[model samples]
Target: MIKFFRNIRQRLLTENKFSKYLIYAIGEIVLVVFGILIALQINTWNDERKAQKVEDNFFYDVLLDLKKDNANLNYYKKFHTKRITYLDTLLTYVRNPNKTMGIKKFGMYTEPLFYTVAPTSYETTFESAKSMGEFNNFKEKQLVKDLSQYYADFVQLENSFSSITRFVENQFEPLMYKLPEGYMSEDTGMLVINEEDVQEFYNKVASIKDNRKITYDYEIILKTPNTENYLIGDMGRSYTALGKIITRQEVLTKLERALNKTIKR
Candidate 1:
């Protein structure tokens, strides 16, 4: 092609017919300009293709992360449900006034109560943090904004959860909830809690149980009176951050399907 153009240009320049030669030179210039424009268009298309691939790869990674997060959150939801139940029973045994008559005293459940039924921060904490970071760094601005507000709210909810956990463990345990009262007796006494005092124990343990249930329930998207204002407000602001992530994951799968289809085509 270069040789052909060079030959044509030389012929036009050297030919005796000046009028024809001038027309031919103008035509050669137009052809060169067209060739340059075509080369530029091809380069621009290649650059866009590479950028879109990078964007797609990042989106897929975010999808994988969100999918794992969803699975983990589900597991923790089940786990906390069981833990709350155990704590309920343990607290009942320790605090129940009427049910204490047994070979072993109600004191048996006191230590286990705190250990087995203690409130815990579930998988949402880690997931929220990861999701927030991903949202912030995403190449897609629309997705970033949509996810950012939601995740911010979820993080606030998680923080309130942490606060409640700390409140129960560090402060409330000492003042409100008492430890197992024990007196070593050489003679065996029927492990007994007088019926009159049962109500008092029930009331105390119930408060703790209610607080724990309220906090744990919030994590699972459950509603309750104890729902902290900070968490509620933040969560409201976030606009279902969790659902957004799930939606994005679903979209990513769809995009993958479309990409696969195009590849086959």
Candidate 2:
């Protein structure tokens, strides 16, 4: 193609009809400029296509991460909810003058520790999106906003868990050791709970007028310097953190669905 254009230009110049040559010369320059412009446009289109591919891949990975995060959030939600329930049972057993402290009450307090450790979210995709500025590449502004909020919520969740951990290590666990030896047996690693006492504790707790409610007054709960209050406060913190995680998970689920639809298109 280059040789063909060059031949035409040479032939036109050889003819030397000066005015015609000038016109042809200008036309040749215009043609060369047009060719360059076309090449540039094609290159730009190719680059854009490559960028879109990269963005799509990021979206898919983000969806996967969100799915994992959602699963973790669900797991912890149920786990924390159960912990709260058990904490409530123990609290009821302690506050009621009629209910005696026994193995059952001890188990209620200790069982929550089985799931006290919070689960961490899958954040690799989110971190990559932030660090690589991939969020800027997204056309939808809501996606950017959702991702930013989701990660921020995760940070808050982590901070909340840290507070809970400090309380457990410094206050709650030490207080547990103060309980009577029969309540918690070190040798058997089981609270020597009587079935009748456990059932009676449950019945009394179940009979409370508002047994399901979580009291948020940490000061009132903590003022007595009782182990029950420390456990309640700790569980309350865990409950609040898990609530935030659930809310964030909902947002993440919406974002994931939106992304999934977008990538399919």
By lDDT, who's the top model here?
2
Candidate 1: lDDT of 165? 50
Q: Whole-model Cα lDDT per candidate?
A: 0.43, 0.66
**What's the TM-score of every candidate structure?**
0.52, 0.73
Q: Give lDDT tens digits, candidate 1, residues 68-184.
A: 645544443443343344335544443444453342332332222222112222235335545556434434665544434444444543553454455446633452232222221
Per-residue lDDT tens digits of candidate 2, residues 163-214?
A: 7777777876666554432322222223322212344444454454553344
Model 1 clashing residue pairs (backbone): 97-198, 150-238, 153-234
Which ranges in model 2 have alpha carbons more than 4 Å from their true place? 100-105, 129-142, 179-225
As a TM-score, model 1 comes out at 0.52
Superposed Cα deviation of residue 229, candidate 1 (Å): 19
State in Å the error of residue 185, model 2. Answer: 8.8
